[model samples]
Target chain A: MHEFSLCEGIIDAITAQTCQQGFSRVRRVWLEIGALANVELDALRFAFEVVREDTIAASAELDIITLPGRAWCLNCAQTIAVGELYDPCPLCGGYQWRLTGGNEMRIKELEVE
Target chain B: MCATCGCGETEPVIHPHDHAPDHAHPHQHDHAHDTRRISLEQDILAKNAGFAASNRRLFVEQGVLALNLVSSPGSGKTALLSRTVQILRDEFPVAVIGGDQQTANDAERIIAAGAPAVQINTGKGCHLDAHGIGHALERLALPKGGVLFIENVGNLVCPADFDLGEAAKVVILSVTEGEDKPLKYPNMFAAAKLMLLNKTDLLPHVEFDVDRCLDYARRVNRELDILQLSARTGEGMEPWLEWLRRGRHDALIQQINQLEADLAAARSRLIHGGGAIRRTVI
Candidate 1:
């Protein structure tokens, strides 16, 4: 799964930060993943456990913060919460809408010693 | 007090601190081992984005129209690419980079179609990242002022996240598949600029609803351009070829404009008598 690849990226970022910040070990990692980011949280957690072995974050706990999907409805002229990309606008039942949020995958912070 | 050996002595020891600190020592260290929270707030895909930016620059400089073809397995991506190459090879240079989990059969097929092709075996990777494409570019000569097709691994989910510095992502859907595929895999359809409805020859044999499929795709991505074609029968290929030709032309024109702007900037520097005139070779 691509979650493994994403985990590799996360580990790379952590290792690079550790080198610069001079941290000996990572105790926890915080991630901000959007609902529409197409990432399975369970899969990501499993991949993180596998990818963090022997690294700075070997025993680090993963903390994920999920963001809700939001979009701007063109017809309704209002911001609406969308669960999926193909979903119609709830108010107008129209397909014309622009996604405004809930597509981000970022490393928010890390607890290190 | 002897904190290192824990000798249970109340008086301070006069020994040098040359020995390693034992686990029992709590406060004998020079620095505090306090845990600190650092705010990074960085995108996880930043590394891949950097590579993709460089690849984009290279494509612009060389005026190469790079298109990433993404789809599910058995969507006839290889067949469509081979046929497209055969038709466009004579007009302009055409090259392909095929990605698969295993064999190089797709690359061989493309080569047989009379164009240079490179096959990237991703092994366990479900998608091709920009870093892999950068390495592949080194192995294959770029088709300057022409089309470079990056046939991504036949996957709909993961490939939607990785950017390979393509001009646009083209998603292929066959009639044999469900009409609600876009609704199921919205991320892939949403990321694509164009969607090709392939295997139209089997539409009559199969109970596929073309209108309903298009509607579902549009709901996912309103701006997605749709085209119906069958790679096997060579039907509705002209329109796809025309789209490619237009894209290549636009890329070349943009390159020319950039070069002209550079030349104008150099002229202004020369007139102003600026120090150290830097000539940018194309």
Candidate 2:
């Protein structure tokens, strides 16, 4: 699954940060996931559990913060909430909308000792 | 901020060193816990995206049209690539990178079709990431104003998320598969820019409905480009070849435009009596 690869990405990012931030063990990880990022939370957790072994975040707790998806309606010239990528613009009921936000998965903070 | 870990502490701590030496302090060594909170706003896919960006830059600099071909197993991706390479090799420089779980058979086929090919054995990996593509590109040199076809592992799921710095993702679907495959694997279909319905010769023998299949694909991606071609029998290959030629031509034009802009900038710097004259060679 792509979730497994994405978990690897998270581990890579954490490991790289450890070298720069001089942290050895990660106790907690605060991650921000967008609503339209298409990541299944359960699958991501399962993948993280499988991948976190032998890493600094092995015992870390994952705290996820979800952001709502937003898009810019081209016709109506308004920002509207979008549940999916292919969803029509809520304001004008048109499909010609550009995604403005909520398509990212980022690590916001970490608690380390 | 706490001195030991430099974290923001909400509760006030009693200062032991500020008191008399004989004064007993219970929380004297409490800071030894040394827990720290680090605020790091970092994208999880940054590493992969960085590699992909580098690959894209290299491709653009080299004027190479790199296409990532994705499909399920037995979708005839290798066959399509091999045939396409054979047809285009005389007019352009072509190379292929084959991704598979184990064997190098696809790479061998591409080579047999008369083009340089590198096989990336992913071992247990389900898809070829940008890092793997970077390594493959290092081994295989893509020609200027040519095509570089990256045949991804025979998977429709994991490959959809990983971008290998390709100009476009070309997905292949065979006629033997269900017509509703686009709906079943919407992620893959949605990620692809082009859908090549391969093995059209088998359509007469199979129960595949072309219209329904196209409708399903359109539902997933309304702007997806579709082409019907039988890679084996050389049927409906004209449009595919034309598309490749068009892509290569556009890449060449882009290289030319970039060179012209750089030259103009350098000329302006010289006219302005800059300290040193820097020349860029394409």
TM-score of each: 0.89, 0.83
DockQ of 2: 0.40
Query: Highest TM-score among the candidates is held by which one?
Result: 1
Candidate 2 chain A has its poorest 10 consecutive residues by lDDT at A15-24
TM-score of chain B of each: 0.85, 0.84
The residue-by-residue lDDT of candidate 1 on B1-282, one tens digit each, is 233223224332223334654535343346767788999999989878888988888898999999999999999999999999999999999999999999999999999999999999999889998977887887899999999999999999999999988999999999999999999999999999999999999987999999999999999999999999999999999999999999999999988987898899988878786434444431
Q: Which stretches of model 1 miss by more than 4 angstroms?
A: B1-30, B265-273, B276-282
> What is candidate 2's CAPRI-style docking category based on DockQ?
acceptable
Candidate 2, residue B206: how far the Cα is off, in Å: 1.9
lDDT of 1 by residue, A17-75 (tens): 75456567899999999999989999999999998987879999999999999999999
Q: lDDT of each model, Cα atoms only?
A: 0.90, 0.84
Q: Indicate the docking level reached by candidate 1.
A: medium
The lDDT, on a scale of 0 to 1, for candidate 1 is 0.90
